[model samples]
Target: MIKSPTAHEISYGLVELNPDGTIQRANDEAKRVLISEDGDSNYLFHRITNNEIKTKLHECFMGRANEFIVTIDNQPVFFLFHRSNNEQSQDRIHVYLFNIYNLLTLHDHNNWNNHLLSSIGEMAAGIAHEVRNPLTAVKGFLQLMEQTYKEEYSHIAQSELDRAIHILNDLMSVSKPEFVQEEKAAFNVCSKIESILLLFQNQLYDINVIKSFQDETAMVVGRRDQIKKALFNLIKNAIEAMSDGGTLMIEQYEDGHDVHINISDSGVGIPKDKLRLLGTPFFTLKQDGKGMGLAQVFNAIQSNHGKIRVTSEEGIGTTFYLSFPKKSQYSTQFIGGNTMLQVVDSKTDLTDFLFKNLDFYTREWVQYLEKNKSYITSLLKENGEMEQYDRAGNPIMKLVAQNILEIKTELIMDVAKERGVKSAKTEFPMHLAWELFQSSRGIIWNAIKSFYQESQNTLSTEEFFTLERNVNDIIDLYIDSYTAYYVNYKEDLLKSHRETVDELSVPIIPIAERVCILPIVGNVDTYRAKKIREKTLVRVKELKANQLIIDISGVPFVDTAVVNHLFKIVKGIKLLGCSTILTGISAEIADTMIELGIEIDNELKTRSDLQQALQDIQQFRIGKD
Candidate 1:
């Protein structure tokens, strides 16, 4: 049966209303639209709709504008209102409602699809271009090998193939970061960066490396290796850009809640027109670069809850600014060493004042600690442990100041206990640790007095006494918690060591004065390799060793990745002014390295056995003396 459509069933809505916006007659669609927006039918019999729509209705009644829009169900619905029979007795308003939501959505979807296809095509072209260059090199090397029957040609081909593989690996990492998962840990930013800078020791001969680390203990929590890789790429690019030898400045400072790291280079800068595409895949300025480096750098930083910004000029230079949320609980509001009266406004302001000038307090404390004639203090200074002492102690002091701002007793105690455990693990003396806290009381009071004096802000006697008591109470709580944890940790040290045997895999044993032996055994994975690098560097500094003996005789097999890690470790040691002697290269491992076309750095010394290596070191030291 064919049915004729009624007025209510038409495509568009129609309504007739009085001059005052009272609904005289309306179709079902018209009623539905009004109900959805107003949420009731009271507007149908009311004098006018709401104040939001009254202006439009008044304009329609006065023969002014006739069209307007109202959002219904999150879609814009157009309304056309016309005053009818203005010259006759029948004074009425005719309204037509139209919805174009589906049309707009279809338009947007088609546009987006076209853009996606275009982007896909561009990326595909870039991949092909990058992949073809290395393949072309490999092909040339293979042809040479075939004609000359030379092993050098084969090695070059293998190296070219490795390059291709590296490019593809980078692409996969940026596209799918989940392919490799890493654990997050809190590490000292200054220390890690210093280590990375050491990797470019050879390249630094022509360049000046300037480091301005304001907050040495600026800590961040992320995948340490990934962060290291990103930093390495940027620093490497900075070095490469300055081919004619320019200054490479790396600066780190902390603001209120974020840490800022700026790496600037004085080199041939990028074009301003191309600045917006700096991090896009396959967009680069270098001739031989794969163009994936910055892409990976951008992805790595963002994935680690960090932000990156870059600015460049054509002839001057470029700078990459990276910011990460600091893992501290204090506010660093003091900028440019300027103190204002606002810093002493109230009790909370006093706490902030202390934090803002924390560096001053730390410097004073370090000076006092260094002046002490105790054996522990002398060893700390001589072994370069003073910097670490400063880094570790700064946080606890900041926490104490934070506690004064707001009372969080449990959190303070837990952190103090953890610090205690750390001290015990590192074999730090409990007496000196306690003395560190005790000495801060006097330093802090002096700073507070100066703070008030410098700002000319006075506090009542009662207020000053109450502040002193609060500070002492929190310090005492921290000391108590730390002492308890320190004692308990010492008692269970052996059990804890047994549970964490993996951590003991990279044991740096002191073989003699100014020398240490690192005996690596078993399989070396990426995770363990990173731990080895960190531990080895730290132990070398602690022992004040001038040379390191890396005995890999016990390492059963050597893969390409392990070789790369070993090479990096040696380079890092070199940067620390320490020489590395690699021993126990078995025939099988040598064959694997050669087959993989690995090239050892010329400066790295090698010996057949540990005894021979020891003899070589003894002769060299004796001759120097």
Candidate 2:
């Protein structure tokens, strides 16, 4: 029986590479690896599932690495590159194809299956014990109600009991070893979805559910209950999101190859950092949330060979795109009695070919930038980084070229995972980053198209789509990375500016030689009052002022803390060898100051207004003269 279809379990191909990273010779297995299994036709070599192997192999040859290990599609594969010893060959490397899981015996696979079953049994037994107590309590309550002839009380009790049962059932459903796939049944998903929506109609009372159907009924091949369970998890999630009452949208549509159902909720959206971790077991954003709901959702979909994609903006909302490949008689994988999902591993080799001509592609990228100078110019305008853009022979253009030349598909994805705010703020902001990527993508694709045209004659439709997707992946990777970083950078920039403004909110202004005014113009909270004290003392020392006047006429109220701060400022100024003057002591401020037991120092002068203080300073200076 076929167990896990890991990458190691799949066939391997050996392709010899010269020192310069050019393909020297490919054996039969390599051709098979490149081609689709159905026709043995040449598939795109760059489209291989673990194509990172090729990049690592190339890196080893380039002397960048001696060994590379990577896990692709859940299978870990590694490569060891060795230098060939020969008088004739100056630089040659031999790479052996080794299967990581080849060490596993048949007995080990059986042991895994046994261990999984035992774990399930243990969990089920625990659940049984918990439910038994509740079940016994309900039985006793029913007997009491029956003896009392209390029909209304019985009904209320029964209703609550039913709710408990429902919740328990939901728990049990998620805890089961399997997410419950219907082994036999073909049903239209349209009806199932409508039924589930109607069930939630009352629950979504304040929430608007907008439903759009491009394909009214989808012919899904699988268990209807299983599909419904997944749909229930998603819709329940949607309902939970709208606590504040927002729109919940469900869109069902079909493209040529797959059916898509998008469920979107206008609620507190997830951040990108948290979005990456959505479907993991016991992970949820909700308060005291268990991941059972989404776990079941993911399990059901995976059981039926479906794919899920999620996109969310922090404030806007979240939308989930669930795709089920059009169930066909032609495409199905069978392991034992279970039907497994077989994704069409359509890929393109043109990427490897393109990687070889990095300089050529870089020039193409530059030509692209030159063509779309107007757009690039618009993006650059008004960005502060523009001053940072004086070209060292057009640094932006050259950097775009370098990104293309050095990009392996894996690097594109790795960049996406890391390009969040910290990197984005330090490197490039979103608008500029996206503009650069979009411009470069056009050029990158143009270069890829040129390479494809060279071999387009023998390529199949699958091969062409593979090429299109791989090229699309390059742009997609850049844009995904660019957008994530952009969002974070914008957020960080806003937060930073807010902090800067808050820091500089309290201003000490110098109006005369060695004399300055510290204005307290707004509502003086404890925070602002503290800032005032800090800034005033620093200003007095910095200016070497003989007099420091604090004006509080614009202040609404002098609270107890504000009074304390004023007295402290007076004391601090005296220590700095400067006389302190209080101006704008309003009747209300004076009363509060008196109540707070604040007394001015004997040397400190109190002025009703700023004009009086300035006049006194002028007279005192004249008298000294």
Best candidate, TM-score: 1
For candidate 2, write residues 72-138 as lDDT tens digits: 4354544566666332245665555433444233335455544444544654554465456556667
Candidate 2's displacement at residue 266, Å, is 31
Which stretch of 10 consecutive residues in model 2 shows the poorest summed lDDT?
A: 337-346
* Candidate 1: worst-modelled 10 consecutive residues by lDDT: 329-338
- lDDT per model vs. reference: 0.73, 0.62
RMSD of each: 20.0, 24.6
Q: Model 1 misses residue 130 by how many Å?
A: 2.1
- For 94-137, candidate 1 gives per-residue lDDT tens digits of 88876645333344445544444455566678888888988999
lDDT of 1 at 172: 76
TM-score of each: 0.35, 0.31
TM-score of 1: 0.35
lDDT of 2: 0.62
